[model samples]
Target: MATVAATKPAETPDEQTLREDLAAAYRLVAHFGWDELIFTHLSVRIPGPDHQFLINPLGLLFEEITASSLVKIDLQGRPVGDNTQPVNPAGFVIHSAVHAAREDAQCVMHLHTVAGTAVAAQRDGLLPLSQNALLGWDDLAYHDYEGLAVETGEKERLVADLGTHNLMILRNHGLLTVGATVADAFVRLFILQRACEMQVAAQAGGADLIHQSDAMGHKVAAQGRAAFAAGAGLSWAALRRKLDRLDPGYRA
Candidate 1:
């Protein structure tokens, strides 16, 4: 629970949208059972030049989160409000690294879902065994586990390993994905988690694996991205619609 220096209050429509999108992502992650008992974090950059971001209050479960309940913090992982809930220091370590180094990482998602962690523990990492795996292809990064990721010193190494990749598998830990938008990050996680599950299940059967060629994998990933960018293309509007149909209270 580090405290951030207070700054003058500022408000805008873009900030509001950022807050709403971040909240929607939390709810969606919870819906998919990717949350880890209020531990895992999903963060989005505020619509400003300042290195500000929004994350869930530490005490609240992902499903219980609402836009108003989300906490704002600086790059140093300090809470910006009067709220008393402790922020996860380790999450700051992981998120700040990406936010600081990768300008395109507008949204950073980390999860401890069963399938994700199970895949991380495997020696071969994410196998190109299925179409879902191809979405990641050779673009995925891997980082060796270093306890709970609480050390500031780990940031450099983490960034080095992540090096221009959006998907990262924290070996023996969990998974991380970054995106230019909340929708993109969510879709990436969805595909990454699916790939992990497929790999685990395929291995469980102890049968020979059917791997995709590198060129085909890259092509599939390119096509998937193109398909996503088509039309409204996984826009926050669509996600909001899904939330409204299921649990509309995330805007509260």
Candidate 2:
């Protein structure tokens, strides 16, 4: 497990900040071309004991999502309020599994991109073909695709497969990442998706690829973890500035 920076309970972010941050994640993911139309989901748990969360409303493109447009739901995926916005039950099935088991996973992101899903289809998961892949080498887990993840029973198996890893590649499906904050999760997902993209490109080259040794990979993994933990927030701040300049509506 990577060393997560200590965040005291008193410093828990308010719901408004969490809402804007999570909304920004959706915008950024869409900006980077990682969104699968209006299909995939990103969620952030509100600070409380209710197991409540904020997620993009169904039928909205990631780019169209605004903080005020986010839907609030309970653990069972039911809307906490009037339930005007559509919520995807499949998203609930996938996200609730992680939230149930991992208390630290305040924000969860899952996506289906070409490189990410292409790598998931392979027999071997992410290969150590690039430094980006090795950064998350030790923290990655694999879960076999079990058809549509709408069945509630699959949650148990999903959580079991995830175990302690923060990154998971759903075989023949897509990618999933968890984080203590939306910024951390977004950064982790960015590196993970890049790693998969690099692996796919290397494999397509039809040439021998360099695979780093486990001993060296572990050392690199440690450094990667520290760097991400230390700098992800800074990157988020910078990116959020860009987002603000581009369109500040996401903060609504």
Candidate 3:
């Protein structure tokens, strides 16, 4: 039998909270066109001795994801407890690698937005051309792409490539980010994608780009940390309120 399928689901309170937050992330990503049909994944680790986590079901649209609709899975991406939903091999391959290695990465988000992919395919990769890029200054990594990310062997190489970085630009692929919280991951992805969009747009104009010195970048990042932290949590709540106004079904 294959390993990445289900056992059952316990659906405890803490796990349930993780489910809602992850589902909220899926909904936000879909609302912003950051979702690629059901290809990419956003997962949050469940609190326990075991390294289990919550991920969206493989076939569901991001907008269709609900708290109870999420699948609980192990590090291998197999369903835990009584879940029947199938897990995405790609999600397991990438997310489990980081979760196993980084205690800081409680939430992992992988996205395939147009801007992120466009910038990633560039040889230089995420030029420090915009203030948005400063959000991840001195805190980014790059991993050379290795096809569709299916083999278990690729997991080790990918995690090694990721190292201690919270944000990674997968060469010729897309953007990846991990955070201690769902809000943090979402904000990092938001800033990275915005940076990519600005870079691609600026380059399209064929204008001479001006980049800040690394020292200036570091200084600006440090200055922005407090506001960035507050804004991420604040904007997340605002967006959740917007979601509730539009369609609160994700909170199910």
Most lDDT-accurate candidate = 2
Cα lDDT, model 3, residue 172: 90
Candidate 1 wrong stretches, greater than 4 Å: 1-10, 82-84
Tell me how far the alpha carbon of residue 137 in candidate 1 is from the true structure, in angstroms, after superposition.
0.7
C-alpha RMSD values across all candidates: 3.5, 6.7, 3.5
lDDT digits (tens) for residues 82-157 of candidate 1: 5435678887888888999999999999998899999999898888899989977866999998897898999999
Q: Once model 1 is optimally superposed onto the true structure by TM-score, how far is the C-alpha of residue 192 displaced, in angstroms?
A: 0.4
At residue 28, give the lDDT of candidate 2.
91
After superposing candidate 3, which stretches have Cα over 4 Å from the reference? 1-10
**Cα RMSD (Å) between model 1 and the true structure?**
3.5
lDDT of 2: 0.86
Give the number of colliding residue pairs in candidate 3: 6
The positional error of residue 150 in candidate 3, measured at the CA in angstroms, is 0.8
